[model samples]
Target chain A: MIEVKHLTKKYGDLVAVNDLNFKVEKGHIWGLLGPNAAGKTTTMRILTGYLPATDGQATVADFDVFEQPNDVKKVIGYLPESVPLYPEMTVTEYLGFVADIKQIPKAKKREAIEKTIVTSGLRSVRGRLIKNISRGYRQRVGIAQALIHDPRILILDEPTTGLDPAQIIEIRELIKSLKGERTIILSTHILAEVTQTCDGAVIINDGFLMASGSLEELTASFAVKKAGVHIRLRSASAEASALFKNMAGVKDVRPQDGGFTIEWSPGADLRDDVTRLVVEKDMGLLEMRPLGMNIEDLYLKIISGGMPQ
Target chain B: MKNIWAVFKKETKCYFTSPVAYVVIFVFLILTGFFFHSLISWFNTQSMQMAQNPYYMQQININQMVYSPLFHNISIILLLVIPLLTMRLLAEEKKIKTDELLYTSPISVLQIILGKYLAALFVLFVMLALTGVYSLFTFAYGNPELPAILCGYLGLFLMGAAFMGVGLFFSSLTENQIVAAVLTFGSLLLFWILNWAAFSAGAFWKDTLNYLSFFQHFDDLTRGILDTSDLVYYASFAFFGLFLTHSVLQSRRWR
Candidate 1:
């Protein structure tokens, strides 16, 4: 639903977004993962037409963001990083105002607002003034405003930035449930969020697009130095460690957590072989597991001058 | 136009619902009342001979009341109140980062600026309406000229519109509302002081610069002369300010 080609935005000498290229397919949730000031917010702002690119082009839902801004705006909802709201307005009043600004059909506005209030779980406090609401509810109100128009694309910058863990989870679930209905491009520094919420992601750092692909593809692209699998033999001792290390698929073995962890060759399945070896040696098999790459390590590998493959 | 109206309604609602609007209204009423009373007292002290002249006392030269003393007085209040009304128009949006919401909406940039401009104009309208009570006082004691009252309000309305335009432009220039308010007030003060400097330079320069003065144009309106040139000037002044605001917003896309 969104295509950004060679997008570059420069504020005089400072390049906020540089030579960025990415496309968001319909019905997919894409995360823009980056550290603070890594150009994620700038990228989202440009996509939403809040700021224009110094060079290149972007289109949303088939409408050029610059040439047909109103058309593009009609289909996209953006929640900026700060969650801007009129504090004097009540939650419902604020949403109504947004709906009006977005020009949602007057007849549909009330129904859409009700849906947004319920969906964002804001019905309980809809009558309370925005300034009096808690941060979590205020954040929900922000989401509600974005959702009130039922746009086809939602661009959220750091949607879960300030929330506690539980609030974050609640919002994440809310976003996840919205997953196939519209295209979502949300930026965040949280690695686990990308793992749990986004199907595809673009990693950026220092105004550069570091990597972009599906979650598994991103992990696989960085899946160098095949990880080791830890195996424990309840009955076997030091002698069994060497035997397991010498196995055909085993490249290296080390003691960890009172057990042996053996690194196997890539693409090699050793679970069957390890089970057979245990049976032959009469060493009882305790646990056998393949180590997976965590998001933090992958994030570091993508950003911290690590290999860009 | 519908979008403009939508924005206008929202902005007006914001003014009424917020404490800022109430505070501005309360302060505005107090200041205007003080000025009105001072004008009447100043007239009272002008010697009973002049004050008792039925022509001077009965009609009360609305031109003097509205154009000369009171016009400038209201201009000073405009310096204060217009900024308060306009400081939040665009600056608050930028500060809260809600400009993103407005920018990304289907509304045009002109609609946003015009909507905000009208909202500020609405407050000025309310202030002008409240001043009617002062006019009623004159009508109670003497035969007031309805044409003078209408003309006086016309000039005040146009001048206030121009001030709103200036304040709106300042609001667009900064994300800090305080800075916007301060800068707008300072700019209006500079305008207020410009004619004095022009006059001190002597007649040739004065005649040339007088045409450029907002006060000169207002002075004619207060004297009850419906000079088309002065009317045209204030309208152009307001339009130019709106045009400047539109350009400022357009330039934002580049930044």
Candidate 2:
């Protein structure tokens, strides 16, 4: 588990991260969403003990990041944005080095390396020098090194920033597989990544918390002007409008192209009610698309200072 | 201790796996071989000429004629070569950003510094040991004072350690290897010529400059005149350089 309370970081006069707060339960994958220069990297560095925070407190696995950094370090694995590594070392050799410094006991070191190798899919290129590997493989090695120690919390800063479409899918699959074992916090500018992988999200812009919650909660936020779900029937019918309108929490309804856009009061999930109501009417439901369905719309809506008053 | 060992092992492995260790050791041995050949041949002729005069034969001192000059000449060679070994110690880490991995691991900064510094010292030890083959040849042909030659080697090691300390400091200050090398060479050259500036100073300042000069204390050990103060000087200078490196790394974190 991780909790950051009132965390602020400053580089002289520049406020990089300003008064941020969030929490992640054990076995949860949380996405940290932001644009460029949004203090994502700075925040990770502070949590990893690589850079000191200007103010506030962050704890990982119940240990304070500032007061007991070494204790914190022992339980956390960090992958920096650039994927820093020793090009001269082979994949297995690099993982071994990380294991040694992390103080993995002598007997368990080999087991840990083997487990991580299989987990990250690095067995095929274990002997190849890191500099000789492809960018995708190198990124895998970066993630491999972080997992060798098996810390309780893992922090990755833009792990898939520079990769092909196929490689991105491979890396994302690897991350999703490790979700239930530890608390994972990954930062990225890509919207689909959060919706596809994270259990929840903490969205920040200009170092301030704009909005944060589960996917459903954030999609139900006030940022969506006419907030709710839009559904399309198998066949066009006038009664389709009346069925959704009678449901509680339904505020407004409109027609868009071949579908009816249903607007609900803020913070209501009408998907279950709408789906059940459609079946009751013996109408074929062709589709249902929620407003701000993907974080792409929600991310843009809130980032543009469009948060409804 | 384990963390330091890990860093030491990694650094030493890096030195040998690349062409750096072989190239550095080869260049050092070849240069010292030429110096040893010329000094021994030169001493042979000088001794032959002095043998003809019964009174002049009393001045036949191989310690002064061969060992002293050889040790002094080796110091100059170290001044040029030590920077090559020390330049990449910290500079490369910062350049490739491996320091991030090193810092975020469960190791202290002191362990990282000590580990790297010890690797450089180990390389220096290797270079000095290879040159020891020269002293063996001298011992085989002529009876040079064993203690004096050994003392001279000790002086050379201490001087080289001091040089490495300065080199490591420069390496920590920059990410570019060339900048680190040039800065190490430039600042070390200044300290080497520091006593020359003493020639024109007032009495008190003259003594201070001479004492601050790296060569001043080294001169005593070359003659086999061992002193506690001289040993302290080199050891302390080496530690002081490493201390400066530690401060640079620590301050960067806070900033």
Candidate 3:
């Protein structure tokens, strides 16, 4: 639903987004992952047609962001980073205003606003002024405004930022529930959020595209370098560490509390071999589990230029 | 068109919800009332004294003595009050980050500028309408020339709208509403005094300064003279102000 090619945005001598390329397929939730000031918001702004790019092109729902900005805007709903809102308006009033600006027909405007109020779980606070609401409710109102038009694509910048833990969980579930219905581009620096909510992720650092792929693919690619397993045995023995180090695929073995951790060579599945050796050697095998690389590890590896081959 | 209306409705609603609209109207009514009452008392005393002399009675026309100065004073009051009405139109949007919502929407920048400008004009219209009660008082007690009064009001409305457009443009240029208001007031004050330069400057400079003074064109309207050139000047002034606002909004995309 969205394609960005060689997107470069420069401010005087500073480059905000440089040579970035990525694609988000329809009905998939993609995370634009990056740290603060990593140009994530700038990229989203360019995609939403709010800001013009210095070079390259982007298209949303088959409309070029620059050439057909109105069309692009029609198909996309954007929630800016700060959750822009009119404090004097009520939740229902604000949503109605957004519905009007989004060009929802007058006959269906009430229904659209009511539906969005229900969807964003804002019915309870629909009559309250926005300035009087809590941060969590304000965030919900922001999401409600974005969803009032029911556009095909939703672009949210840091949707869960400034929320309590409970509110964060609720919002995460809300986003996850929206997974298959629309194309979502959620930007955040939270690694766990991407792991928990996105089908694919595009990692960026210092305005450069560090990596982009499915979550599994990215984890698998990074796993090639530091793949390992942790085994907890009933008995700790120096002999077991020596025996494991001598194994063909085993690269190193480190003794830990009550057991040993093993690192293996790339493209090696030493689980079965290690299991058999542990059982046969009577080392009292208690627990054996493969350690898959999480997004934190993958992010660190990519940012530090240790990209998988 | 619908987008503009939507924005217009929201903006107009916002003006009432906040205290700005009430305070502006209240202050305006009090000032205009004080001016109207004093002018009427002075006119009554002068006319009573002139009643003794038949020659002077014909020269003391109520329209000249009352409506002309009334409308002119209202116009000057509008000059001071318009910036307050327009300062928050665009500057507050930028300060609160709501410009993202506006710019990213499907609406064109021209529509946004027109919608906001029209909303400020609407507020000015309401304020003027309330002041009409004072005009009704004049008609009730004495004979004030209806055509001159109407023409004076039309002139004030147009000039006020032109000044509002300029204030809206200044609001778009800054994120601080105070700065926007002060700059708009300062610029309007400069134009108010531009005619004074005509006395010191020679030839070309005098004509240029006189032409730039808003009150020069407005004076023609107050005298019940419907000059097409004066109408064009007010219309063009408002158009240029809105045009500059549109350009400012468009430049933000590039920035």
**TM-scores across all candidates?**
0.91, 0.90, 0.94
Tell me the docking grade of candidate 1. Answer: medium
Question: Of the pair 1 and 2, which is ahead by lDDT?
Answer: 2
What are the DockQ scores of the candidates, in order? 0.72, 0.66, 0.77
Runs in model 3 lying further than 4 Å from the true structure: A225-227, A231-251, A256-259, A264-292, A304-309
TM-score for candidate 3: 0.94
Per-residue accuracy of model 2 over A1-309 as CA lDDT, tens digit each: 889999999988999999999988999999998888888998899889899888999998988988898998999888999898899999888898889999998899999999999998988999999999999989998898888888889999998989999989999999998888889999998888899889988898888887778887777663435468878877546778876778899998887777788888877888888889888887788898867545677688767877641
Which residue runs of candidate 1 sit more than 4 Å off their true CA positions?
A225-228, A231-240, A246-249, A256-259, A265-268, A272-288, A291-296, B41-68, B200-204
Tens-place lDDT digits, model 3, residues B1-255? 999999999999999999999999999999999999999999999999999999998888888888888888999999999999999999999999999998888898998888889999999999988989987888898887888878888899999989988999999999999999999999998998899989999999999999889989999798888899888889998999998998998997778
Score residue A290 of candidate 2 by CA lDDT: 69
How close to the true structure is residue B210 of candidate 1, measured as C-alpha lDDT? 76
Candidate 2's residue-wise lDDT over B167-237, tens digit each? Answer: 99999999999899899989888888999999999999999999889889989999999998989988998
The iRMS of model 3 comes to 0.9
In terms of lDDT, the poorest run of 10 residues in model 3 chain B is B141-150
Count of clashes in candidate 2: 0
Which scores better on lDDT, 1 or 3? 3
